[model samples]
Target chain A: MSLFMDLNLPFTADKKRLKTLLETAAHLGFSTVAINYFHEGQSKGKKEIPKPTPLAQLVDELPIVQGKSRPIKVLNRLTILVSDASHFRHNAAEYRAYDILAVQPTTEKLFHAACMTFDVDIICITVTERLPFFFKRAPINGARERGVMFEVCYAAAIRDSTMRRYTLTNTLALVERNKGKNIIVSSGTDKPLELRGPYDITNLAQLFGMSEVEAKDGVSSNCRSVLLHAETRKTACGIIYTVKTPNDSQPKDGPPLAKKQKTSAS
Target chain B: MVRVKSRYLLCEIHVSDPSKLLLLEDRAITAAVKDAVTSAHGDYGAAQCSIGFSVKYVNAHTGILFLRCPKSSYRLIWSALPFITSVERKGRRISCFLSCLHVGGTIRTCQKFLIRYNTQQLHRMLPKCKTQEEKDQVRRAILSSSTYMLKGKEHKEERD
Candidate 1:
């Protein structure tokens, strides 16, 4: 199963720290990393404006390959705090990252804008306090209305274990209702250290009412689809081809590698 | 590929004189149209009304609005459009028509309405229009300038 690690390093986190985190993720079998970066001065109330760091530099400098493994993909997390179409366009112009993980209570106008500007794959609705409002404004039906995939971050599920069932049930109902449109369920955790792997995430989905197949798809296939659609990764289809010398090639003379042939031989 | 089943209450109001349409006040009818649409579909905030549903066309002057509903809930809501105020058959199947005053209604009036009125009214009432012709009409109406204005108002309230 493919793994994705959310790299929520602080703005102050230097390149060295980021390198260490990427190394750790690569070592642990993560195929993709989603880096969440927001302007600090906007929130910190600092008048002394720091020059905007080019996001492209981070993408270019990120250690995507370790040793001889396939290069790990890096995606910038463009979380729209409140759905602002202009802000999304501005961000798209500035960063031009592969994908956006937008938070909602945003208008369909803005959602469409982000998708058009950045070619967004997954629009994550941050249903923290505004669960009802979030569902109302950007209803599962509305996502279908706008012809876009809608993702729900189970904040309450991750925060309070007791609320997990309810969140899961409601989210599942939403997913079932909008089955054709893409629905992604995530734990919306910011700290990379606290994230859960695909298997654990699958287990959580199962506990919350997703069938084994559904849970597996949600964590592995669904998550991959989201990350791949983001700006960081160019291709979502995880197809890799390896070329080998004639001597290194496995023998095609071995009965076409079918299990039936092996069993018959045995 | 997204199908929504939306329910709207179309009240004829039984005005004997058709020429007295001016005295009827388009706003009142529009308000009723808005109320029926909201009650049947759910509150989508005025701003979202235009873009959220399959509103083919609306002629507030003649009190006619054409809408689409997803197939799943079409039976529950669409049939009830003509008889919204009647309690005996509030959620039962019934014949409905679009006001000729509005464009495109004459051609697609017989189209079925799908309604699934749950506690969440807005999402439930949307119709799943399968045919490309029906889907295109709904998309155009929902994304029109008037509907976007309505959605913008609802959005303002959320921000406030």
Candidate 2:
């Protein structure tokens, strides 16, 4: 079975609370979790992107994941709230620090741009409030083609009944547009009590209009693909360069292998 | 004559505070579960869960409970179980969640599964016992529990 992962856990300044959240997540059987740092764009003035906190400072000893003897893996994620086209900077140097990049676009135009052109792993759908615009087919398909996953957060639903209605409504709309493909459900939770087990999240996904297989994928395989998508964003076309160890007696060549291949093709 | 079928759900409630488990009552759990089903699936789920649905057993000390519902609508209730964040008691809510351990068609099968689960838990606890007396006591408990279960089954067969 694929290891369960929660791709979004809202970052908090309180070290104690964050430690408890990580412990609870591991106890609940999530093998991987990401601490999400959110930055909302301003229209007028320049805003500095928030830096991710180092994982070592949060917890001294990582807790072992339940049923998996190994320790839980923690990742840093940055989510930029893009209200306007100018909000998101393309290939910003600051974004490389995060393991995953996500954007929450408030407008249809920004949403389309994020889907087709933005270098992001996940697009967070608005769940706490009424959706300002309808989800169109073009952007949804474009996102799927580009391997960008739509994220539906359930923590808001757990907090209030009104948010619950809005969450289900927006999720159903997204499911309709995408036919339940390339979507992931994550608990953007701030507290340890808000975290649910992976199977529970799967059941909750079914209530969001996904089939059994799709709901299972929402918590397991879909999240794995998103991690891979984020990894590829860090490399050149998903290719990595490795340095030979000193133990190897082979002499270095004049040109790199990739450049040599390109020159030969030309 | 045809017999009606039902599904038994064995669930364990996890509370942030262990003392809050005592505040959980059968009626409160049933109401919370029904409310969750209504909100999650609307009136259709509420209606489906209302029929032949009941809290069959509750053990506050162990935090284990059994829920019974019709075979067809059991999925509706099982899915709704996760949405039950807490049970309200005396104007205050005790925040908790239920983790389902097993689902069985017959209560007997559920009881058997619970026994096996408890035995496994005891074995796991055996290694943590600091004193030899404590270890011996746990071993005795495990053996007695199994024999008691077998004796009860034999008595039931004789009566039948």
In candidate 2 chain B, where is summed lDDT lowest over 10 consecutive residues? B119-128
Model 2 ranges with Cα > 4 A deviation: A241-266, B108-160
- iRMS of every model, one decimal? 24.8, 2.1
Docking class of 2: acceptable
Worst 10 residues of 1 chain A by lDDT: A40-49
Candidate number of the best DockQ: 2
lDDT of 1 by residue, B1-160 (tens): 8544444332222232345333443334334434444553465433344443354444435434455433344333332232122111233322222211111222233222211111112221124466888766655654563465567679889999
The local distance difference test score of each candidate is 0.44, 0.89
Put down candidate 2 lDDT per residue, B101-143, tens digits, no spaces.
Answer: 7789999999988887777657656766999999999999899
TM-score attained by model 1: 0.40
DockQ of 2: 0.29
